[model samples]
Target: MAQTPLPDHPMRYALANELHARPFPVLKAPCRAMYLAIKKVENAAERDRSEDLAHLEALLDRYGASRPAPNADQYSGKLGRGFLKWEMHTEFVTYTLFATEPHSEPFSPDLFNLFPRDWLADAPGRIVTSCVVNVETVEPEDREDYMNRNFPGWFVPESLTASAVTEDTAVVVGDFQIDEHGHMRFAVLAHPDITDSRLGRIVQRVLEVETYKSMAMLTLPTARKVSGTVAHLDRELAENAAGMARESNEAAEVLRRLLTMTAEIEALSSATAFRFGAFEAYEAIVMHRISALRERRIGDHQLLSEFMMRRFDPAMRTCRSSKGRLAELSGRAERAANLLRTRVDVANQEQNVEILKAMDRRAALQLRLQETVEGLSVVAISYYAVNLAAGLLAPIGYKLGLDKTHVVALLTVPVVIAVWLGVRRLKHTLTDGEDGHG
Candidate 1:
C-alpha cells in the first residue's frame, strides 16, 4: 500500500542536514595537524565569498579532488595521503590538513608544506593565524617522564599552560606564543584508551580556543588607537558643560561646539561598533571552548583558563572599559546638547519679547503723533469752512442788521465742531474695517 504524501517546507531537508554538515574530523592518536585561518584585514565580512570558494577550488585542483557543491560553506575530503577540511565563516576562512603519522621531530614545520608556497601566496586573504598541533599517545606511567623530557625545551616555562582535560582523557599544552616559523604550537598527549573521535574533538577545541583568542585580541589595538581621541572628546565635553553654567559664555557658541562634539562622538561610535561587537562574540567563543576542555590543573602550573584570566582577561576588560566610556561620553554629549538647545531657545524667546515690546512703544508714539496731526487737520479744514460760511451769512446778517464779525463768530465754533466730528467718525470707520480684516 502506498502511503499518502505530506506537504513539506522548501528548506526542511536543507536546514536539517546543515546540523551535521560540518562534523568534527575523526583522527587516530599519533597524528599531526596544520591549521590555518585567513581573513582580509579590511571589510572582511563583506568580502566576495566567491573568491574564497575559488581559492578552495584552486587547491582542490592541485590534488585532482572533486569540487565542493556550488556555494558550499564547508568541504572535507582526502588530499594526497592525508585529509583536507575547509570551512568559510562570517569574516574568515580556515583550512585544516590532518596526517595520521606524527613526525619523529615533534612540532615539525614540514607538514605545513602541504599547502604549497605559491598557492598560499595567491590566497584571497592573508593568514590571521596558523598553528601546528602535534598529537601523541602517552601511557599513564610515562606521562610525567615525557613532560620532564620535552616540555621545558618546547615551551616557555613562565607562559606555558598545561592541563588534563576530559577527566584525564588527554593532556593539552601550549605557550600561546608564535614560534620562529610564525606559527603557534600545541601538543595533545592523549591517554592510551582515548578514542579517535575524542582525540579529534580535543584537538579541535584546542585550535578553536587559540583561534578565537587571537581574533578577540585584534580589537585591543583598535581600542588603544581610539583611546586618545575619546579622552580629548571627554575633556572637551566637560569644559563645554561647565561653560554652560557661566554667564560670560555665549550660549550660541557653546551650543555650536556641543553639536560638533556630539557629531564626533557619534562618528567614533559608528566606526568602533562593529569591531567591539565582533570582539565580544569572539571572546565568548574562546571562553566557551576553554570551558568545554574541562581542564584540571597539572602540578602547580597554570591551566589554560588561568593563563587567559591573567593575560587575556585584562585585554578584554580594557576593550570593555573603552566601549563603556564611549557610551557614557556619548550620553553626556547628548544631555549637554539638549540643555544648551533649551538655553538657546529661551534666549531667543527673550529677544523676541524685547522686540515686541519695542514695537509696542513705537506704535504708541505713532498713535499719539497721528492724533495731534488729526486735530491740526480738523482745525485747518474748519478754518476754510468757517470763512466760506461767514461770507454767505453776512448778507443774511445784513437783512437782520448784524455785522461781518458777528457772522464770523457765529459760524466758527459750529464749523470747527462739525469738522472734528466728521474726522473722528472717518478714523473710527477705518479702524473698524482694519480690525474686521484682521
Candidate 2:
C-alpha cells in the first residue's frame, strides 16, 4: 500500500511568503471560532466544501419537515463561514459550558446542566475530535484565581511581570517558557480577561488578538514605499524654497485643489514608470527609517512627528545631494514621456504607409474590373456581328446543299478565337506601356 503524505498544521502562503515574511490568518470572529476544520485555501476539495453553506432558516424548517431530531431549537448556532466567507456581522451563538458530568451521553449543556470541561470535551475541530477553545478568558476580581490556575499555554507559574488593574479590566502580562524536549518554547501572555462584564472582556481580547495578527502580516516592502515617497518630498522642499513641494500654505482652503492639479499630468502616458518610481521612493524611506532606528539616532515616537513635520515644513531643515538627483530625474522622466509619445507617432506613420499601399492595390483592382467589363462588351458585339454575317452567308450555303447550322457554328469559332487574341494583345500593350501613346 502507498503511504499518504502528512499534513502541515500551520499552512504556508505563496504571496505572503514572497512579499511579506509569513502567512496571515484572520484571528477575528466568525473566522476565529469556526465549527469546521481550518484547511489550506489551495486545497480544491476543501474550498468546494466551504462553498456548500446552508441557510439557517432552511435548516430550522427541517426538524420533522426539513431538520432532523436536533432541530434549530436544539442547536446554538446560526449558519456561518463553512469553506467560504460568512456574511459579515452575522454570528453563531457559541460558548463553553461547565458541567459536572461528561457530555458524551445525550445532554443539553444549554440548560445549565453541563460543566465547562464537558463543553471542552465536545469541542469541534477539523480532524481532532476533542478540539477545545482556548479558555483564557476571565474577570478582573477573579484574575488572581486564573493566574494561580496557570493555564496550559498563555500563563505560567511565574517570572517577573507588570500588571495593570482597573475596576472593569486587568491586563496581567508575563513571559513563559515551556519544555519541548531539549528546546524551550517561549510565549508572551497578556491575560486581559479581567473586566466588569465577561462579554466586554471577550470582545477586547478578540479584537486585540486580531490587531496583533494583522500588524504582523503587514508587508515591509509596502511600508517602505510609503515612507520613501514622504522622505523624497521632504528632501525636495529642503533643496529649494520655491519648489512645488516647499510651497507655503497661504491659501489654506485651496490646498486640496492644488494637490489635485499637481497630479494632473495632461498625460500619465507611462503610468508604470510613475507608479514604480513612487513605490521605490517609499521603499527608500523605509530603509532610511530602519537604519536610523537601528543606530538609536531617533526615538520610537519621533518617526510620526518627523514625517508630519516634513509634510508641513515650508523649507527643509537640511539640503542633500538627493534633491539634485531628484531634479535631474524629474527632467529625465519628462524626456522619457516625450520619447514614448514620439515612438507611438512613428508607429502610426508606418501603419499609414501600409494602408496607402493597400489602397493602391484596391485602385489597381478597380481598373482591372473596368477593363474586364469593356472586353466582355467587345466580345458580345463581335459575336453578334459574326453571326449576322454567317447567317447572310448561310443562305448561299443552303443553296449549295450544305447544313446552315454547321456553317454558322464553324464561322463563329474563328471570330471568338480572334477576339480573345486581340484583347490579350491590347492588355499587354497598355500594361507594358508599349503603345505609341505611352
lDDT of 2 by residue, 271-350 (tens): 22333333334334443432322221111212222332443121221112233333444554444434444544666687
lDDT of 1 by residue, 233-267 (tens): 98999899889989854889999999999999899
CA lDDT, every model vs. true structure: 0.92, 0.36
Clashes of each: 0, 23
Candidate 1 runs further than 4 Å off? 1-14
Q: Give me the candidate number with maximum TM-score.
A: 1
For residue 295, give model 1's deviation from the true position in Å.
0.7
Q: How far out, in Å, is residue 200 in model 2?
A: 6.2
The Cα RMSD in angstroms, rounded to one decimal, for candidate 1 relative to the true structure is: 2.2
All models, RMSD in angstroms: 2.2, 21.8
